[model samples]
Target: MNNTHRQIAVIGGGLSGICSAYFLAAKGYEVAVIERRAHAAEEATFGNSGLLAPGAAMPLTLPGAFATFAGRFQEEPRVLLASGADFKRNRWMRQTRQAQQQRFAANKLRLTRLSAYGQELTRQLQEHYAMEHENSSGVFHLFRTPLEAARMASLQEGAQQCEVKHKTLDTAEIRLLEPAFSSEAALAGALYYPDDIAGNCVLFAKQMRNAAQELGVSFHFSSTVKSIQPEFGGRVALELESPHLDSRLTTDGVVLAAGMQTAELLRPLDTPLPMRALQSYSALVPVKNPDDAPNMALFDDSYKVAMTRLGNRIRITGLLGFMPPSQAIPPKALRNLLKIAGDYYPNAANYNQAHFWSSTIPILPNGMPLFGPTRHGNVFVNVGHGVTGWAAAVGSARVLADMVAGEKSAVDTEGFLPQDLAA
Candidate 1:
């Protein structure tokens, strides 16, 4: 299939959409990305923990997970959930219930394959195009107790099946690897994934967008698509409005990667995409003493929080809300993050000047992203990546572009079909 004449429109400008445009443009297609923000990565692509660990793509619906999280959400102030009613949220809860241990394992395995594929593509992009994102490798999954070590059981199995390299480290070994863990509280064992990486997804997306622009991919910033409808000859048309322009647009193919608004985008086409939004919070506390800060990415599994060192700042990201979009950060949530930071790496950052951020992530109950065709073969989706969006961006784009170009994808497309989680 010669894609030289195709004009592809991507309905988002975040990591997933930019990566999609990058690949499509690389393949000689006329690509255009429509972003509502003034710049790229201003939404879900911003403020993530920045760890690109394929080993971290575990499913949230493990056996007894619902019970555990139900109790945890009720007991732990950091573990958040909404009691309000949302049609999609309620349906998603039921689907999560159906995705017991068997489905959880299946989803995790699928995610592992996609993660491996995406990591390689990400590496290639960085090496080939000179993309910058504060690149670094090695992440520590710290376990403070034997019970925490036990929780790593299933993830370790999946990592082995994926043939990823890792090392199990004891307390002394962990301290040697990262002295900030020298505190008595940091004692237990941990699994160190050597290939896990950390980088600014927003920076990577901006650089990739520049590369795409050089390849003649048009980007329309501050443009929001009002509606999408199927035109004659199997084309999808977009009615867009912006502060500067209100117009109609059409393309040979459309890829929905618009983050939280993706389901709304597809609704006009009557595509029943089963995804609910989870508003997440994070804080970027400036490093007051960089010399004392831990350089390796850290994941406190017990608290379900992650901390990463990004240059002179400590990026602490965690906390999940089962509700829709909002910028308001709960005081209790911020306090919880501050506590985590202070406990593990005391005096490493200046909490007084910490920067807070919030964004919505689209989650499917099955914990796998949606890919391939929607109601129409020409319409594809690459949303529902959740936290793995940063790691899986490039590979998802590569696969989406291939499918749109009538070529086979690089990863297995079995569980990635459109509306696979619409149960």
Candidate 2:
């Protein structure tokens, strides 16, 4: 298929959409991106932990997950539940529980492969474009107790199967690797992935957008795509609701990469995607002491929190609360994140000057992202990446572009099909 004459429109200007446009343009297609925000990476891609750990890409539905969720009301809880459960939330929980019993291993493998591919593509882009976004290497998974470490046996198995290099380190070894770790804090052991990396997600996205533009991709910011309808000649028409633009635009194909809004857009096309939004929180603080700050990324397994060193700043993020959209940021979630920062690296950053952030992350029940054609012939989707969006975006976009170009994908596209997750 010759893509030189094709015009592709990508919905959403976040990391996924930007990468999609970049790959499509690289294939000799004329690409345009429609973003509701004024600029790229203004939403979920704005503030993330910046972790790109394929070795640590495990499924969320582990054994004894329900037992853990039962402690949502406890002090410094890792997971929070809504006071009132809606039908969508209830259905998501039910499916998640079912997946816990049936799909953990498969989902873990799927995520591991996709994340590994994405990390490679990310490094390729950085080296090829001479782009630097405060890139760092290594990831440490800290466990407070033996039981906490034991729960990751399945993840370790999956890592081995995926050939992801990792090591089980004792407390002394962990402290040697990261001497700034507090000795007073309880610690049993840690899993260290030396090949994993961390970088500034927003900076990387903006740089990639520039690279895409170099390939002749146009970006239409503050342009909201209200609806998508298939045209008579196999093209797709998009209804726009931008203050500065015309009402409609038609293109050869449309890719839906909008987080949370992807499902809403698919509904009018009669494609039902089973996805739920999870509210997550993060805090960015200026590093007060460089020697005391971590050299790489750290994940506290017991608390389900991540602390990442991004240039001169430290981003502490955690908490997956199934709550209402109108609800304010929960005080308990903020306290838990602060507690982790203080417990592990109290002198590393200016805690009082931390900037708090919250965003809704769309996730599938099986903890795997969907990226492929939908029921509509010319419409494709690249959404539901959850918190692993940074780790999986590039690979998903590459695969999406391959599918759209009628070419064979570099990676196996078994469970990533949009119809595989349809309700």
> What TM-score against the true fold does each predicted structure earn?
0.91, 0.93
Residue by residue across 180-265, what tens digits does model 2's lDDT show?
A: 98777777777899998887888889999999999999999989998999977788889999877789998889899998889999
* lDDT (tens digit, per residue) of candidate 1 on 1-423: 335439888999988899889888887788889999998888878855676878775554322334434575344453456665556655667776687434766777778778888888888888888766787788887765575567576777788898877788776777787887646556466788878887777788888888889999989899998888877777778889976655988888888899767889887677867777776678999898876788888777655567888889888885666644566787666877887778778878898898888778787777677777787777878887765456766777898888777787778877777756544
Best by lDDT: 2
Model 2 scores what on Cα lDDT?
A: 0.81
RMSD for all candidates, in order, please. Answer: 2.7, 2.3
Predicted model with the maximum TM-score: 2
Clashing pairs in 1: none
